[model samples]
Target: MISRRHLLATGAALGSAAGLAACGSGTPGQTADDAKKSEAGTPTVTIQFWMGKLTTGEDAWYKKIVKQFNEAQDAVKVELTQVPGDAWEQKLKAAQAAGKAPDMYIGVGNNVSVQVGNGELADMSDLLPAESWDDLTETAADLVTVDGKKYAYPMLFEPQTVLFYRKDMFTEAGLDPEAPPKSWAEVLEYGPKLKSKGRFGLMMGVTGADFGWQSWGWQRNVAGHLPISDDWATAKADDPAYEKLATFYRDLYSQEIVARQALGPANDSSAFGQNKAAMMVQGSWGISQILDEFDNLADKVGVAPLPTHDGTGTVPVTIGNMKWMIDGKSKNPQAAADFIKWAIAGDDPAVLLDYFKTTGYSKFPARTSVTEAVASAPDADTLNPWRKVIADVVMPAAALEPQYDWTVAEAFGKAMEKCMRGDDIPKTLGAVNTEIQGIIDKLKLAEKAPQ
Candidate 1:
């Protein structure tokens, strides 16, 4: 329940006071075996897994992963609890307060930051083979790690976002579908051509803001505005990257090429799929959905990295993986960690691929060997296509929240809403960045001071 700001303060204080004592232990808690002894008499160790709706068609793919896991193992039975991903923090906090919570659960970018920072997760440091884990992608691997201890594996892999264009729209606009814009200017130039079809050329216009603004915001992240580092805070809203970002957004808004109400809760935009909008930035999660919805989607839906600020050949597909972390307080840490190991092992992951027929590779396996196994998976028609592209395009980009705090994003959300409302670029951005800097300064001071 600790806020990230408070946690940073506590960490700094404890680091000074605990000094050498904190360095020897894997996690700042009682050992897993100690917790297990308290639950020794249970007939079957049902390891509670708080996960997104994936099992039983409430997001069936996740369920299949757990179901196959249960059938495959004898040491533990996974009790899969469906937790809405968006509200996972509330779920975890509520469950913790009630003394009823999952032993192992899925984690996304924000969850990892909040939970791991609070030390609510099991430090899978020694539970799983460290060598087996060494093969993970750095950004993907770092998703669940805080300090030197790791709590989750980057399970499903993808860049933060991908740029997809409507082939017909592009052709009509006289732009090549295969050759996407590489810089900020080209996208602006192409924005107007799709107007003949009554389609907005750019997303992030008020109409597509919810799903699209983050993509545009992430353009700054790919440009290297990270959250923190050993040297200093990596991301600052006032950074030139963000200033540039706001200016670019202002231009897009002024051009009137972006759709109105595109970003609001109910704004309808099928222009990208309807061959109306020329291009849109989306995540790997959208690939299968796009393929399913768009007629002749594969040929018509061109996939390319998003445009960069300086054409530095560095595209920021935001980097992250769906994560699974075990509760340090769980009664079955060993069993829980075992299940995670089994789920990711070679050939074993193919079982999950078999379960989700349509959203194949939507949850790309984390391991390289598993990726290879999926490459030749029997049901690859559903899985392989996305895996190849996601793997290729997901260059090491920025994570959503750098400090394991949503405050930065929350600040951006406010700024973005105002930007969409047509606020002044400099003053609005300066205010937001100041707010972000204020948070960062407090966290930094807390980190440096003694507890």
Candidate 2:
């Protein structure tokens, strides 16, 4: 493992060492003369970046990472910037219109889908290694892949959502703490029991819905009912699978098993802390906060994978990731790709495993080696089991996280939101599916039209 001592030592530790320690050898992004002068002068190459808020003290960690890269390599210096969560999508649209979008970005699974189709993003395939990238997890590669061509360098591979339960409360309710429901029917059965105890059985997001995000067909991708076919065309949003999943989500709330909360207003974990609900369908990352911030209830909490519709327990959940694309218009494509490779190496399973263990989150490495290293991690006792699940349960499902440009998902989210709010299902689904078809056709991604 790379040590902090090695990272902090300066001078010889400064330039080439930084490259070797981090990105290794960079493909030259500039002529020798251009790079030579950069080393001697006040070096700068404003490569704009858009990424989510990293909790690790950004100033303490990220600023240092960027500075080291700039000093270590004459490649275009990264001009780090934040894309505020709420306004990220809006700002991206505005920037693209002005022809001044960031050179690199970290966005959600759906954003890539939209940008890729609009030709708003650059291809990252040429710069990355084609073979021997076995360190990357099977699913991590899928997050940024489309039609067999890779676009994004995977950043983090995580279970998009997980189920959380209370320990003390279960004991008081005379329920076995170790035994959580294994199927959706079990959850419904337990809901009434939880309610009898004056505890809210389940908590839903602001929409008070479940079916919107995770689904039977689209989310699981088992049916291959993509808005675009393998080539890129719209398929049916009203397919049997879609309707079955929608009913699954809606019935929970209507049956009083899931309750609505302030999820839309702010972060969802905060709602759980208020003690208004007993359980939440939350991201695996939340485990860290619950254990850290809510010390009073730390031991009282335990985690279990969500109950599935059937005993199979297969989840549609996936690892969320974004690719780092080089600016096609960049005069220094080589340099840009070099920086990107280092930046994305964060996905290398080894790197990810360290991050997940050290951070106390449920994230698994995007690479296989990192996942294997769990036995050696200081936090192995906690990390190992989750690592097994990520490698086997979660990683296998990750291949389904919409690798094709996400334009269809944009339509999917909008259509679902409307229907969740009681909009006409037939009209909304029809219109959204039509819009998705147009997007697929525009991108030349779908091969055959729906009959």
Candidate 3:
């Protein structure tokens, strides 16, 4: 998950030319006829690649791997560029409009569906080897596939909702740290017991945008559907299950179990790290920040999948992943595919393993081979003990984040905020349903929904 803080930080340096140089011996706009011919008269193809700038050292890993690939191979040359997260959409759109877009670029999470609809991404099913596609974890593979055609190659996946708590605080509050809350009812029951004068029992997003995206997993747990129906033609917010989910959060705010004002964005762990809350609901990437900022609290932290409504053992998490997609109009589709396969799904797992290590093992690997490599590493467990819990418990049960229009998520989020602010639940939900139906009709989303 990309936190608001990270986005703001990168957004500040919007026009700066960072990581814009092309790697290897290839230059941008090199045509097939311009490729260097070998002794066999076969040309070496060069492809352009772009990725969003991530705060987790992902850019560095990409640069390193691209350099390594260029030095080790002669058949395909790759030119790499890193774009700021905030500027990515505008820049990529301009490039594509001018017909100078990079051959391949990183696919933004949850927005790939829109890109696919716009014909921005190329079909990868016939470009890469079938076994390479088979190597991806089922959940990861499903995320990048639309209508049974692979549009992107997944790099990593992070669970969007994980329970992180303080062991010492749990003990002080007369709760068992070893057994965290397994249901929404347990969370309510335990939250009050953990509250004190300065610190609250829980920390989570309470704003409209925060609640909108952050509630995806919880919505699945409670309602088994998003605000829109599967066909994307009707609004489903009026369902009793959605009302129940909204009312639960409203009670949490009204009773002061959680802060009336948000401590930080849902993706951030600063409040928990500063001891303002005993427990927090955050993405799995939060683990990386905690370990880096407060190494002393490493031993005091505990992780578990977010609890479901009835404690029925459902994981209640949305899988957040980063993937690479080729441009639909790329002149070097095969060369671009070769680079992606070598970096992520190749026989050698060394590059991918090093990336996981650099991320502090906070992000989960998308490929089974990379998972095995990480598990067999000597320092895997010692470096991060939560890996097993996330892999064995969270990944299997997690659902793909909804790929519907952003306005649909915003509509549901605003309704959730209204209920939390003391508005009548039924009235607010009814209004939300009408508003969402308007969106569906205006956008003709029913016709766009993948079959």
TM-score of each: 0.74, 0.74, 0.82
Q: How many backbone clashes does candidate 3 have?
A: 0
Poorest 10 consecutive residues of model 3 by lDDT? 10-19
Sum up the clashes in candidate 1.
19
lDDT (CA) per prediction: 0.57, 0.55, 0.80
Q: Compared to the true structure, candidate 1 yields what TM-score?
A: 0.74
TM-score, predicted candidate 2 vs. hidden true structure: 0.74
Provide backbone clash counts, one per model: 19, 17, 0
**In angstroms, how far off is 320's CA in candidate 1?**
2.1
- Model 2, position 312, has a per-residue lDDT of 61
**Pairs clashing in candidate 3?**
none
lDDT score for residue 341 of model 3:
66
Instruction: Kindly provide the TM-score of model 3 when superposed on the true structure, using C-alpha atoms.
Output: 0.82
Once model 1 is optimally superposed onto the true structure by TM-score, how far is the C-alpha of residue 54 displaced, in angstroms? 6.8
Give per-model CA RMSD.
10.0, 6.0, 8.1
lDDT of 3 by residue, 135-184 (tens): 89887887788888988999888888899988899999989889999888
Q: State residue 371's C-alpha deviation in candidate 3, in Å.
A: 3.1
Ranking by TM-score: 3, 2, 1
